[model samples]
Target: MPDSKYAAYQPAAPYFDLVRRALGDRVDGAHFFDLVTDETVYEVLYDVPGWPRVITGRDALMAAFRGYVGAIALESADRLVVHVADGGAVIVIEYEVRGTILASGVRYANRFCSIITIGNRKIVHWRDYMDSLAAWAALTAPRGV
Candidate 1:
């Protein structure tokens, strides 16, 4: 059973749980989509000049995720913090991903911080932050192991 306050919000625990399962391990694609509202929006901000921020709706977001599916293996969430307020929820998740690049077979390890907003028990918005230079270096540098 889910929290009573979230009863009206369709697809409650299953939605958020799936993300934990999907990213922490491997899971079916359909499961991931179940949690996202049709109008869900995602943004990735970068501080670098000339680097355009990424803003896209559900379909585009899914597409972008698909491109990285097999390219990186999301290992686990390090610090997952959640805050619920006035009919809305925000989750801050820090995670590590490691795998070989599909194109170069170079091993990579990187960390990410994602902030997700939920409304009506469905995800409405998401923003992610990561060290781009660290990601690039990890992907191209020699493996520690």
Candidate 2:
């Protein structure tokens, strides 16, 4: 779990990297996989094609990311803002991802807010919110338009 070896794409690497640096000693892990528990729960607030509303386990989450990469090839992920609270047990992050839709070749960009809960020095749960309209626009647009 040292790297994003589990995911087909490391699109969200930059956002987590920033969080790792911000949290510093407060969090335990070198990367995304390293920071989360084996049975972590990742919940997305909105409905999407590949990503489900609720995902349990790190492997399942990575599998979902793989599905996402199939549709959207993220080029960059940044503009991260992190807030740590509850004695470092809770963390809120705001970020953005920019890329292109594989099917339509339309530019893709979206903002996200995630709330992570930690336990035993590992991320046990995550709740995510994103701009679904932006995603819809990118995915629905004509190819190379």
Candidate 3:
């Protein structure tokens, strides 16, 4: 895994760009599909032994996601449902990510619900919920074909 943290100049995923383009024209207070950087404060509702529950700043969040993306080769990330509420201060996003684990060769797919707040074209807060048991099953499965 890479030791370096996130750089503000680094490029984000295409899915993010797509959403940004799609929503930027409509939304004023909310920033959709943008990278969470050292300036971001993100929180995950799920709690595991080793993983972080409350992510503060960009670098830590990026590192956590980097570890995940490094293990899983993402094929698609789709937002099934999106609801902009609370005067654009809170955005609820339901999405699914499909991928294959590089080391295990196992198909990995997971559903997620995220409540995010964006301001000044930056993600200020994020809360994520997902199927942790399903992820554990896929990640811990046998490695061979």
lDDT of each: 0.54, 0.77, 0.65
lDDT of 3 by residue, 6-31 (tens): 33312334334434543454444322
- After superposing all C-alphas onto the true structure, candidate 3 shows an RMSD in angstroms of 5.1
TM-score of candidate 1 versus the correct structure, residues matched by position: 0.62
Please provide, for model 2 over 1-145, each residue's C-alpha lDDT reduced to its tens digit, 9 standing for 90 to 100. Answer: 2354645455555555665665567557787667777689999999787668999997787777777767777777788888888988898988887888888888888999999888888889889999999987887788896
Model 3 earns a TM-score of 0.74
> Model 3: which ten-residue window has the lowest total lDDT?
1-10
Question: What local lDDT does model 1 show for residue 41?
Answer: 75
Candidate maximizing TM-score: 2
Question: How well does model 2 score by local distance difference test?
Answer: 0.77
Query: Where does candidate 3 stray beyond 4 Å?
Result: 1-37, 48-50
What's the C-alpha lDDT at position 50 in model 3?
54
Residue 96 accuracy (lDDT) in model 3? 78
Per lDDT, the best of the predicted structures is 2
Which tens-of-lDDT digit does each residue in 1-145 have in candidate 1?
2345333322223334435453432222334455565687777775433233674565665555554543444432344444444444676666555555555656665567777776665667778788888667655655442
lDDT, candidate 2, residue 127? Answer: 94
Model 1 lDDT, full chain set: 0.54
> Model 1: which residue pairs collide?
none
